[model samples]
Target: MGPVVSKFINELSKKPRIERFSKLISGLRNFNKTDQKEIIKELESVMKAMDKNELKGALTVGVFEEIKRMIEDRKLGSDNDYLLMKCIGYWKAMKNIVICNFGKSSLCKRFELMIFEEMNKKEGKNEKRLIGLYESYYLLSDDSIHENLAPIITSCLLKVASDKEESPETEKEVEMALLALSEGSRGILVKGAQHLQEITRIIFHHNDHRNLTQLAFQCAWRFMINNWNSNSNSQIVVVKYMNFLTVVKRELEELAKCVDWKREDEEKENSLAEPKATQIIVRWLDVLGYFFIMCNKWDDDFYELVRFIVELFRTARDNEQEISEMCAHALKMLAHNENSSVDAFEKCGVLDVISEELQQLKLENRLASDCLSIYLQIVRRLSNNSGDETDEEKRKELKRKMFEKLEEEGLEDVITSFHETLEYNQSYYDHSLSLNIFDYFVNV
Candidate 1:
């Protein structure tokens, strides 16, 4: 469409094999007509104009060699960081070219081996070169690349994370490595299992610094979440590699203690500052819900984990509302597992605790709206084993008995609280949700 693209396409069609790409190679030399950005855009557009298959075949040594020469040439890279950044940007832009014409193919593998040879520790650490190479690989990374690339990249990340003597400047390198792992294909995540434990240990160490914790969880969660599957082989691998879940569970259990750490002070003082350490507690609970949803059945320790959550709901600060909302959601997921029974939690006084929390919401109204679904889910889940009564009148009586049981369990105002929410919701704001909420109660 543009003159540069039009001229490049015309010149490309006029040649064959390596020669067809001559205009593109020379386009990098800038004949005083355009800058690096325009040249990069022209290269991108030229690739788009040709047949993808033909383009794949035409992908030859000349194009890569030219780009490589341009980058390696000290005048462009070594002398100017800004220009080197642009060169890297140009490389990233060509990812579509790599993916379109060469991705997952032996060609990609071949290119990677070349990069690895150049970037090897024996060759010494060249952050610029490594960054460029990894950035390109990160862009082209997918399922096909993972089987080969994951182990290599994950190894690099482990090394970075484990190096206690690593400089502060190297944090980016560590982050880049983890990011590459996080973005890998599911097979890559599976492949990443061999190094996961060491990686987890390293991440836990770094998470103590807090600066790296978010990416730490992301890197850890990526492996755990991606490898999670129902297949027999995957299950074995997931279970073996998924001790990170136990780590996370313990950390979450401890953080749940902070939920009520300052409840008395928080209730009375707007001046009370929330601890930054506890900020991610709700997010941790939310992530745990995914784990509960995916696992086929409870592990032997899962009952204790459930008990922990129940006690947490009884104590955690509801001022933020997220803690309780996510806890309730995770409980709902546990209920969805037919093998999971509410009997154990019943003995823990969990129902009574949840009821009192709902009543607490009623007086405060700080989290009343958020707790509605939570309260309703608690009541419905507890009523799962209502009875074997068959007759309609008998069922009505049974349902009434269930309601009365809820009152005895400390949710005396549960129905009344839900009604208030239903009224408030339907009057002005919610329609579908309001109708659903009304049905959840009325149908019972």
Candidate 2:
């Protein structure tokens, strides 16, 4: 049965008229979702079998005109959303074939521009529907399409960002569209950084819906980071963008606290599932870490990012250890970055909080060796980078403070263990050198 159906699809695909294909697809509307899915899969397979030359021959101006006419027909539009969806599916499939066959030729690029312009004319609620068509194209299309379509996608994203009436769903769709379009287009991101001021305004506006604001900020961070890494001239703009991230990070932290309270209330009432509560906190921490990485500029804002991590450790409850661990991991990554400043780590009191936690865990017999290892690494990094004599004094002060912390925590043994490892490595190297010399002399 499957082979017969496959053969039929292949035979139908050979027909020159897209109108006939549209009619055939429309006839499948009465089928259930599973059957519809199977037909769509079959259509994709059949389309894949046809060469680009064949597909291009099939996609005539007359066929597009007919599809446009069908879209305009109110009865068809209302009764057959599946027809619109399949048209989108077919166009996307053909676009991929052209890209794979032709590479980045002017022919493929011109076709993309024409399709985008046609889709842009779609109006009312169908604007979203049409945008989905382009989005599918963007996702399935090659990176070569980015050179032609990125500006269009950026313009659409800016329009959506500025629209006062744009709903959360539209905002999300637009974000996805932009992400798909920008997948490998770092050049486009560099060109788009000039618009960050306006984008930041929309994101930081007080009445902005939460999810939309988060998505916008996420996009902005990606745009800023991509440009910053590509062009040194973008650093100032990137730093300004980091300031905005600090604000959003604070809001996310507050939101996490609200979620914590809500979870406690639900627990008291026995109304919340454990998985849902866990998801809420996990997402919050994820956002927190994302923003931290974005604000990695070696400035005051970077210190604020570290402070956000410290606050998580200081305020987290017993049940929120997962959140605490996530915060610790993020801080560890930040500390590892060579560009990160020691002053920021110190100003945020991160080391103090870590030492305090280590002490508490030791008293409870729960101090993992991993925590001690992280502490030792942090100390080594700080010591290695402590600058000239003037700064060397500050480094000594920091070392003194660390020793005091060890005494307070009774972690003298952990410090001794770290020194013992260093001494053992030195002795091992010396013995190995002596054995090598002895072997050489005996051979001589």
Candidate 3:
């Protein structure tokens, strides 16, 4: 070991936490005094030992300022490869700390420019180069700094994902890029809406990789939900152009082919297929549920979406309450859509499924509270819209058929039983939902 590293390690062991920051800053300042690798490694060790508050203290005393200066001085030197590697290593240790405490510091502007400059350089298909720049960007990417960095970040991520490189390093780059996009700020997603098609393709391409797929889905979900109101001109353009529903529809079809609903029980026992496939389906279902609740433009694919959601709900593990709850919530949103027709729900077997679940609940002599609350809300919405047809004669005919089906399925009796059960148990929220369902039924 070199003299500087030996002394730094000795002092690190002897100094208090706050004093360690001073030693760390001093070590970084003396980057040229020791062998670059030895000094960089020891510096990382010192910085990594500090907790958030210690790192915050370090920041208050200008640790990042030292990093900025060292990186700049090395950039002017000839043998930069070693220092660049050290820089990436340094950032790997400091990224999370910097991200959490970035808001409290005034060094954001310099950090932003430093990252952008590194990312913008043409490094000739070097994965390490891209990785270093991306790591730097990941550390600097905050809601406060995203506006300046988003375009380059998006462009770089799209390029990387499109390249389809296969390596552990490339995978890390793609994952970080996708994470940044996934957690983008409110208008950030809307601003990137024009690239939704490319992002959709990336999602499809990476569907086999669970982490990549999850991040991509999260990105799309954020984009859709964040700009849901679309009150501004840019938001309106985003809503008009982005077709997230179509993507959701296509993904559901793909999932349908992958999993055999009838054999799901057997498949669950295979051990190899346990959580990975289940998690992907859960996230996609979450996206679908949120899409229905937020966007009102699903009329084009309403029937297919409903059919797919209902089938998933029908086969969902009855013992796993959260999955069932998500499916019910999605259906409930669909039921409340203004464009939804009673005939469409009837054809898609939605009405039959709800009735069957209610009957099953009676046989079991139990109520799944959350699912029941949403199911009751669905029933009330459907009943209230029994007269949704425009022509008076057709509206009356639809109302008559809906009422007859409701009676034949014993929905009235089961719903009434649910009300009595909630009242007997004195449940608060679900009891209110049940009362509203009864009001709708009585008025209808």
Against the reference, the lDDT scores of all candidates come to 0.51, 0.49, 0.53
Residues forming the 10-long window of minimal summed lDDT in candidate 3? 89-98
Q: After superposition, how far is residue 306 of candidate 2 from its true place, in Å?
A: 2.2
lDDT of 1 at 1: 49
Evaluate candidate 2 by giving its C-alpha RMSD to the native, one decimal: 14.2
**RMSD to true structure for each model, in Å:** 14.6, 14.2, 10.9
Order of models, best lDDT first: 3, 1, 2
Q: Give the distance in Å from residue 232's predicted Cα in candidate 1 to where it truly belongs.
A: 5.2
Clashing pairs in 3: none
Comparing 1 with 3 on TM-score, the higher-scoring candidate is: 3
lDDT tens string, model 3, 1-444? Answer: 867667766767677756764565545545554455565565456555544345456655265555556656663232333343334323333222334334344444555665655666676445555444544444443445456566666666666656766666666556555544443432254355545656656655556565455434554454445435534443333334444555566766665466544555445444332233443455566555555555544345567767877777777745333455567767766555554454556668766676677766642232344445545544455454344346444445545665776678766777666665565433543334444445535234
What TM-score does structure 1 among the candidates reach?
A: 0.47
Q: lDDT of model 1 at residue 241?
A: 49
Cand. 1 Cα-lDDT: 0.51
Residue-pair clashes, model 1: 1
lDDT, candidate 2, 1-444, per-residue tens: 355444545566556444335544553444444454555555454444443344555544444444344444432333233333444434443232323322233433444654566666655446655555455444434444555566665566556555646675666555554444333233345255445555555545533556454434444444434434424344545556445446545655655656454356336334323233333344444444443444444556666766776786666635555556666656655655555665555668977777666655532121233344346545665456455676666666666676676566666654443342333432532121111211111010
Better TM-score candidate (2, 3):
3
Which residues of candidate 3, in runs, are more than 4 Å off? 1-176, 183-246, 260-273, 318-322, 362-398, 420-437, 440-444
TM-score to true structure, per model: 0.47, 0.51, 0.52
Clashing pairs in 1: 259-317
